[model samples]
Target: MKTNLYSSIIEKISSDKFSSIFILVDENTEQFCLKLFIKKTGIKSFNKIIIDSGEENKNIDTCVSIWDQLNSFKADRKSLLINLGGGVLTDIGGFAASTYLRGIKFINIPTTLLGMVDAAHGGKTGIDFKLLKNQIGVFNDPLEVLLDNDYLKTLSKEEFINGYAEVVKHSLLTDKPDLTFNSLVKLDLFNDSEYIINSYSLVKNEIVKSDKYESSIRKVLNLGHTIGHAVESYSHISDEIIDLKHGQAIVIGIINELYISHKKFNFPLRDVVSVKKHLKKYFTLIPLKENDMENIYDLMVYDKKNEGSKINFVLLKEIGKPVIDQIVDKELFKESFVFYNE
Candidate 1:
């Protein structure tokens, strides 16, 4: 276990305050990460709960199953649930732990780069509803989070690249004007992951501290999420489109929203072009069809961020300076989809 990545959990585990310890894992994590976790931490005695992987399983059914397992194992309020997987696992696992017995102590041991950089650290835990991304969730911080870069080595190139989108999002949100196309320009993965995860993930944590419930400033963190989520939802339902990973949809969301920002707020076109150019190297242009536009648009119309009838978006005047809760016209939102396709 990396000293810096661990928290007081190690000592707490040793102290025997919890009634029992449970490790939650998805199918993928159980196969790939479980052995390494036990070997490294020397924590051999714990109940293991395994769920199927993929965003589709992030629903009430799975939550019920998890709750059932916890009940079967006789988990108590003092019991600890440690989530050992990616975003899907952490989201549903955290949500389960929070709701079960009116919230139990849970820790996040994220095994994916995306989970490490974005999902695991933030207190936002959720499961998708009716294919809408993160439609059901609560803001509850974990007991602790463990980030080990060694896990990144287990990911395939595509899985590794899936997380790059968030890293790019964090860079654009930072004051650093020099932050350009982070991994696209060739970054040494494990060697630089600590600095990248620490710095960029902190950007989210600071914002979250200010607005944990997303009632105000936290909305800025949803920069690409508005449209990104709709895209993700569409992928879940549509036979015409292949499934999109969360970060890939978010990448599309960033591009589309940036177009709206430039059109509405006079955000620099040069910067927009720079972002598109750099992101193009990694994220391909989404194959959005003309017929699919209506479906996608309808999804955004019912998006969680919308204020009654007016759809809300986060736009930037420049990198790091975000204007939140901007009411974008429904027509304009459609235009962004067109702009993204262009």
Candidate 2:
């Protein structure tokens, strides 16, 4: 366990006399990071609740199971929950804790890059509804956050790269002007502990500063998620499925929207080429079928961020500039996919 993560949680939990400690884990995280969590947090004899880990299991049933566990344990308002796992566990657990007993103090111990940089930091907690992503959730801040780089070793290669997408997005939006594509690509991102921790802190601080409630500046965080989630949902339902991690799907969304941005904003060609070149190497372009396109467009319309009939997208003005709420023409959204146009 890293000292920073241990100290961070202690700072919050030590301030109160709690009923008991409760920690949440999914199947994978329990196998990978449980020992370290116990060693560091030292919450011996804490109640442990485990769920099946995947996008498919993030639903009402899982939430109900968690609520039942808390009820059986006699968990009270002062009881603290340490969410120990990836984004799915953190989101579901946070949602359960918030609704349980009208919310309780919880700390996040994220074990994946996707969880650490994005899900673990922000207070956004929820599960998907009828294949839509994060449909029901609460805006509750965690009492503390713990990011230990050691957990990265447990993530699969795809999962590791899945998270890199957000880090890349952060650099594109917030970093110094000198932040270039090549420099980010060449970054020893996973190997160095300091780099990973710094990146987590950087994204966390940026979101916390801008839209702690996810109403304004935090909308930038959804740059690729709007379409990305639609893509994930499409894959989950369709017959000719395309399996895509959230980051990979978001990368595709970035590509499709890049075309839109190029047309609407006259975004620089060189920057577009740079982004495509870096991401294309990792994620192959998946063809979207006609039915897939229609379903995706429908899902995108229901996005929580949409204000009216027009769907709002966050697009780039340049490499380091992000512009939001650029109303996307519905037709363009459909035609942008090669399979749909064909």
Q: What C-alpha lDDT, on a 0 to 100 scale, does residue 63 get in candidate 2?
A: 94
CA lDDT scores, all candidates in order: 0.83, 0.77
- RMSD of candidates 1 onward, in order: 2.0, 2.5
lDDT for each residue of candidate 2 in 1-342, tens digit (9 for 90 to 100): 345658756655555677788879988889988887777766566788888888888899999999999889999998988899988888998999999989988888888887887788778899999878899999888877777778888788888878877777776666464444445777676565457556645755766777788667777777777777888877787778666778888887877776676767887766666777777666666777777778888888887778876688988776656788788877777655752122
**Per-residue C-alpha lDDT of model 1 across residues 1-342, encoded as one tens digit per residue:** 366444466666666798899999988899889898877677867999999998889999999999999999999999999999998999999999999999998999888889988999878898988767788999899988887878778887788778878887877777754443433245654467777777778778888888888899888888888888888888888998888998889988899888889998898887787887877877777778877777877898888778787678889887788899888776777787777777
* Candidate 1 weakest ten by summed lDDT: 176-185
TM-score for each predicted model, relative to the true structure: 0.94, 0.92
Root-mean-square deviation of candidate 2: 2.5
State the number of backbone clashes in model 2. Answer: 0
Error of 1 at 306 (Å): 1.7
